[model samples]
Target: MADKEIAQDDQRVAVVTGGSSGIGEATARALAGDGWYVIVAARRVDRLEKIAAEIGGGAVRLDVTDDDSVAEFAARIDRVDLLVNNAGGAKGLDPVKEADLEDWQWMYETNVLGTLRVTLALRDKLVASEGLIVNMASVAALNPYAGGAGYNAAKFGLRAMTRVQRIEEATEGTNIRVTEIDPGRVKTDFSLVRFKGDRDKADAVYEGHLNLGPEDIAEAVRWVASLPAHVNIDRIHIMPRDQV
Candidate 1:
């Protein structure tokens, strides 16, 4: 279906950033299955198009870190009942003393500022719709482990932002719901990207351990979005059985 067609319909509209793969892709599929008009936004047009096609939704190119890109992406959407901020990721696993400044910069830009840019660009639409904003965070936000300095800081910032957003929206009478999903060790391309395409290293992170898949987090998002507008889920800390 065309973007305009979906906008004209009465179905609730949802925008999923980083919808090309992993949890984002799964969330798009899940929401579409539940009758939402899903718009899958990501830099990889090919992958986004494929998911959109499969889900009978729309696809738009989005680089959350770029101001112009975010503006353009937000301009194409007429309505949004749900906004999934899922574009963030970890960069490196170095200690604070040995931290890679470049890695930290990337992590902050993508995980922290990227969400900020996208949320700000779409803030008006969200307010108009009285929408829900679901920020995909990690357990690192709550529990900092060694060699996770950059990721911990980035997610911690996200957690803070999510809390403030909830408060601001509530106080302003926007009726917008905000939720933060902190997953523990979801098995996806997360480690691969963090390890810079090291297959062996990526494989080792979840090997021999019970790990949550992208679907698990997707289910959490679906459930959160499914709730009544008056019922807000403050935060969800999801973990695999063996993790803790």
Candidate 2:
């Protein structure tokens, strides 16, 4: 648990959840490159320490699904100018009739409720900074496929939350910008985790296509956060050239 004090100077602080690997890791690097004092929070303490050291940032152990973990993690951070709710992923790809309730539960708990916990914990910090929140959603939230019931439902719930939060923030004059980022396919450990470490099955999903990488989406996140405070990008959809 490496706690970082708020910068004495004018450097802005950003907290990126799920920062151990994949898109979360990439986003942390990208933000650090652009001079943001990024706090990378994830469950992998060792990896987080390495990343935090390399980027000259801070790292905290955080399991978004756990209430105590989130509470303690939030307590360590003093201020946050940007909150990237990127702590989520797909669990399993099963049809509705043959759905695994456990898989669904994991997906919902991690993807939907996880975001809720982090957002609520940091909502006050964001309000104080008049910050921006970039929620990492997916194309699955928009178009559901046959074998993506669990993931789709979780992402859809996240999308709904993002929209409602945006409206509420605007109505209440919070000046907090909310953006949803939907990426079609990114060649990360995402597929591997989705298939529960079945490398062959995961590889097949991007076997012949030129898929997007985590850095690409990270670049998008950096750009979104760079915009002027008054500018609010509602939602941005990105995909590989081959992907629809």
Residue-by-residue lDDT tens digits, candidate 1, 8-112 = 458899999999999999999999999998999999999999999899999999999899998888878888899999998988888899999999998999999
Write down the TM-score of every candidate: 0.97, 0.98
Which candidate tops lDDT?
2
Off by over 4 Å in 1: 1-5
Residue 42 CA displacement from its true place in model 1, Å: 0.8
lDDT of 2 by residue, 1-244 (tens): 5555565488999999999999999999999999999999999999999999999899899999999999998898889999999998887888899999999999999999999999999999999999999999999999999989999999999999999999999999999999999999999999999999999999999989999999999999999999999999999999999888
Q: Which candidate achieves the best TM-score against the true structure?
A: 2
Task: Tally clashing residue pairs in candidate 2.
Answer: 0
- Provide the overall lDDT of each model, using Cα atoms, as 2-decimal numbers: 0.93, 0.94
Residue 21 Cα positional deviation in candidate 2, in Å, after optimal superposition: 0.9
